[model samples]
Target: MEDFEQPVLSVRKINKQYGGGCASCRGPEARGLLKNYCPVCGTVYACRNISFEVYAGEILGVVGESGSGKSTMMECLYFDQEVSSGEAYIHSYKNGKANVFAESSQQKRYLRNHFLGKVYQNPLLSLKMNFSSIGNIAEKLIAAGNRNVKVMESRGKELLEHVNIPLYRMKEAPKNFSGGMQQRVQIAKALSNNPPLLLLDEVTTGLDLSVQASVLDLIKTIQRELKISMVIVSHDLGVIRMLADRTIVMLDGRIIEHGLTDQILEDPQHGYTQKLVQSLL
Candidate 1:
């Protein structure tokens, strides 16, 4: 899509690194030591100069292999992990003028609760195993400053229903549910705040093929009904092809190609991307 209107989310030159870089790996292009690691200093360059935009009500997919840093980028966007260096702006936050990465911890928490939602690949990261599925959703609502138990409960039940979780099971704990059920609960919890933007990191990674299809359908339904912008990270190009309007192909911690999903799949330019598409077929 054209950039005529302001994007819902804008991120520029995001770089996340672990450990200090040595001279041997400073200028990654010149050094080229390993995929994203510097054996010299034991530093791992997880993400490097990644940039992209997510327009209002659109899904932007980030596809890559395990070490390609797509998940790291998602973590940075949701503030689950701090960026080593970058600027990110959300249209609803400070009118898209302020850099969220530079915001205070309290401000980030505010954004997470009121402006953004994230569903982790691992339900353990976001869900309280012992809490009722509805209670998990209520926790997010409470974080967003909702104090009325009746309102929270009503909202939680609505979300669970939307995600296809039965009302009778709303009181059940996620620990007692199946993997697919737990993911559905997480999706319900993520949408509890009705945030404008959603971050999905490897959401369908570890599920049966049939279960994956169901969850993918649930995500598509949520996107259509909510019309919310999303940044979905996955190692599976097939998932990206099915869900994303626009896609970014990342390799070696950097974006190798980005364009409309169909265009990239039909005429992938990068060697890595071509292989990815081929494998998808």
Candidate 2:
């Protein structure tokens, strides 16, 4: 399969379930009752049997309503949350390949340090409040083991320009910048190391239409110019249409539809997908 040609990232049969209440605290007769009261949402399965592949240079968009496990799945891919079962395979240009679930702690650390870049739904939270935009971008380089101050500064400026942030404002703190600019800075930070895969979690979610369009264009331009693959998670179909070659529509922790952007948009087969298309239209 084309998808098996050393995909940048692959998620296989992922089943993430939250644990239920403490049965140890309950009496023998009440043990059954404890099952109904999950300590975390009563032992719900946030994601079930989720499988997908993202090849290098492909932009795959995952769309769904709020509380549909979009963010949870992204978190898992980033290694921010441990998977309860199944696996995520990350193939790196330098590190060869490693299963996210099976890697030792040191191996996982190496993968995170060298290969992954993530942008969250809120740029403000992702960025450091104490650092300037340049500092923020430079920090990633430092974390990646680049120690030369001159090299870090040069790369930081190049990244800022690449993301369309002005050179003059590079010294300004992210908190002082507008929402759109802050998002651009976050993108710059994510691109600092030029990782093979980028996970964008609704980077344009709260922006105005005009700002949103600009951010989307920036992202598209960066993807092409950098030749990097991405997995964008959003609830907005319009956003997916603008950036994704392939779209995956998810609902209630399951993928309701997956296909070419036009196929999914113009001729949706599933009821949930149809509703999404209607909303977009």
Candidate 3:
């Protein structure tokens, strides 16, 4: 992996909350209590004060169980959901000075099309099952302002081959392909524009163990070949161990621990982190 002196993406004090904060549950007294359902106001804190830095060509893992705010963090970064409060800066987008959270809708769309690539947990969300494999990739190219059909088709074929999809199946609809193949197509589509940043949310979930291994290997290969930065969100500690350079452990919407993947596994600092690592053993 390539090394860098500065972070490619920086997120600061980000929070995504539901419902207005109750006076009783809004201050220091409510620090740990905020993760629980606020009985007074029925508020749910999806993410509270999340902050992290992702460097170029690095794989940063965000690991947490369901409702631990990891998915929420991914969604916020993808612009699928807005943050209730905080700032995020992308070094490539604006030299890390402009707050990405404050971008105009048009600017956000531009960023999504030109700079970001995201693979959702569900192929249904990332792939257009009705479209042919080539067509699906072509859509991303078109979104990035490429209109030459021949060029788009050529690039699509190259991406499909890179992801190891058989050339004979390039015209098949994703709905007809196996789940693993569908995911490969999704990855190809996400990489269509050669994005600078890739966000992966539970990419290997629900597949056979063998299939999961292949997919993870493919991701690692892509990272090495392309030198693109990634933020991977998964509940599986093994997945983090396999792919992450650095990892952040989250629980109850707060980050409980973060460090090098080996360090976190070998000597966990937080109680929650210790339990998670032990469970993996």
Candidate 4:
């Protein structure tokens, strides 16, 4: 495991709420004798006091059930959603540092353009329907302001090959590829900008065991080769064990336990973590 004097990303006391009473304030129930049905308890809390750190070059896995806020917290950290409270800080080598919550629009744009990359579970959502794999990756690099189009093309080809997608397939739409291949294309797209921190949300979910293992191996190889920090959100303990240096187990939007992956897998301190491990066995 690697240690960092400063973490690449730090999240503290985050919170997110949705569908509050305001949205339902004027519903039919609020109009008459059924007023009690519009009780102000309509708000749903998606995240609360979530805190964690990702050290440079270390892979941190977050595991939890469906409604446990794993994806919400990841999205908040990545600035996909505005945090209701607390702070998310990203350490930047280029322009000092800035909190994801406190940064100005320009600063946030700088961070998104230069420092971060994300991979979603569905590759089709990430790709352009009208563009080929090479074109899609090249377009992102160009949009990020890389000057040389030929260099972008070359790099795109190299990345596709790096992810084990055939060079010939580079000209085909992502829809033409298998789920696993599409995922590989997504990985290539996320790496197109050479981001220092990568966030992966259920990257291997819904794939066969063999394909999942292969994708895991590819992710591990990329992490090792690039030495970039990674945060992976998944429910699969096997996937966490295969890729994570450390694991954090969450439930009901709170971290129940955290430690070295091997330690947690072998002897979990929290009942929830133990149950999860047992179910895997």
Candidate 5:
């Protein structure tokens, strides 16, 4: 029980909705519709006032099926997608007093470059396919203002090695590697800046089972070694069981239940959650 009164990351009332709302979906006059969508307006409420806290060195798992807005939430946090309305605070940023969503473009860039790291499910989104794997790591270091060529090379090698990327192939382009290898390179690059918080959006989703296990093990090792706080999104309950200390279950753009992973496993309150856990068995 570290002091979670001060969270590494605090998110409050974050909302993301696609399309304009009609009278049937707007404000106090709103009526609920099918699965986070308004039939009258064609408005999809991707995330509805989602809020959570991530404390230092703890992994918070967000589990939801496709279209549940778990991925949308991660995108919003990383600023890949803008929020319709929300507030998020990072303890390392302005002493946790500033709302990141309201920050200027320059300030947000600074936050992304220095305080946060993200691993997208698609390696193409994260890695420069043509650049040498080590060069990919160097690119992130450069963004963080590391100008020393020798230092950058050393750090890159160290990270790639940590992720089980052979130094021999460090000069190879990610485009030439297998999917799991490409993801390993992406992980190396994400850690290059030594970001305090890491956001992983379905990193192991499309990998082979063995490869997923390897990546998951590597993640556990890194969390143990670096004590980095992580928010991992997965549709797979097994992945959440293995990685998350605390788990939040999301459905139809809202969190229906959240608790200790074991507690949720042993005693799920929500019908959807019960079904999800039963599927694992």
Candidate 6:
């Protein structure tokens, strides 16, 4: 195994709660001390002290059902949402010592453009539907400071090809494409800047089975070819089994079990994980 001591991405005690942390939520001396949920204040713990490490070239899977905070965690990492507390370190950022959570808006924008790529579950959230496929990919390259149209076009074509997009459809708008095709374009655009870390939030969620298979295969191929680190969030155990080397199981916003994907599937330790695995079987 590669040395994971210096992970490509390290997250510690990240907390995301949606509600004002009232004094009552903090201490019963004010109201009644609740551990994670605060009935008095209605404080919902989207992600509570979630911590993990994603090593270089490793695909770390987060498996959880809806409202389990898996998607919330991804949102926090991508900065689409804010974190209430905790730290996140990206190895390629400021020589690996800087905390991304503490970066200024300008610095965070730079990191989002050059260091991280995210494919949201909904293409509407990630893609410019009116723009042509090539345009979508070129937008990312442009944000990364590429001014040459020919260079951007060349890179876009190459990426589209890598994602198995038809070369003839390069100039077509993504809104006209099928769901799977749109996602393929999204992946191409996300990879246009060659980000070190890729965040995939249910990329294959609603696609047809065959389409999902192709997308998954393409993702696996790209990961192997580029050796990129990825954090994939899915409730599908089969998806986790196919892509993740290590997996974390979440229940009610907390990680209940984590280990190798096979180990977690075969011998789940937590009651929630056991039920999840059994449901899959």
Off by over 4 Å in 4: 1-3, 19-40, 93-96
Please provide, for model 3 over 141-191, each residue's C-alpha lDDT reduced to its tens digit, 9 standing for 90 to 100.
Answer: 998899999999999999999999998999999999988899999999999
Count the clashes in each prediction.
Answer: 0, 2, 0, 0, 0, 0
The CA lDDT at 225 in model 1 is 84
Off by over 4 Å in 6: 1-5, 27-37
Per-residue lDDT over 139-182 for candidate 5, one digit per residue giving the tens place of the 0 to 100 score:
99998888999999999999999999999999999999999999
Q: Per-residue lDDT of 52-162 in model 4, one digit per residue for the tens? A: 888889999999998888998877776778887888777764333556788776767667667788888877657886689998888778768888978988999999999
Query: What are the lDDT figures for the candidates, one per model?
Result: 0.91, 0.81, 0.91, 0.82, 0.93, 0.90
- What TM-score fits each model? 0.97, 0.89, 0.97, 0.88, 0.97, 0.95
User: 1-281, model 2: which lDDT tens digit per residue?
Assistant: 12347788878877665674355323324334332234423555567678998887899999989867788888887777888778777776334455677777676666666778889988865799679999998888887888999999999999999888999989989888888999899888988887888899998888999999999999999888878899999998989998998988877666778889889999999998898889888
Model 1 pairs whose backbones collide: none
Top lDDT hit: 5
Q: Which pairs of residues have clashing backbones in candidate 5?
A: none
Give the per-residue lDDT of model 6 (tens digit) for 58-149: 99999988888999999989999879998999987887899898988888889889999999999999899999999999988888889999
RMSD of each: 1.8, 4.7, 1.6, 5.5, 1.5, 2.4
User: What TM-score does candidate 5 get on C-alpha atoms?
Assistant: 0.97
Q: Write the per-residue lDDT of candidate 1 for residues 1-281, one digit (tens) a residue.
A: 42438899999999999988878888747384688888888888889999999998899999988889988888888888999999999988898999999999999999999999999999999999999999999999988899999999999989989999999999999999999999999988988888889899999989999999999999999999888888998888889988999999999889999999999999999999999989988
| Selected candidate, larger TM-score, 1 vs 6 | 1
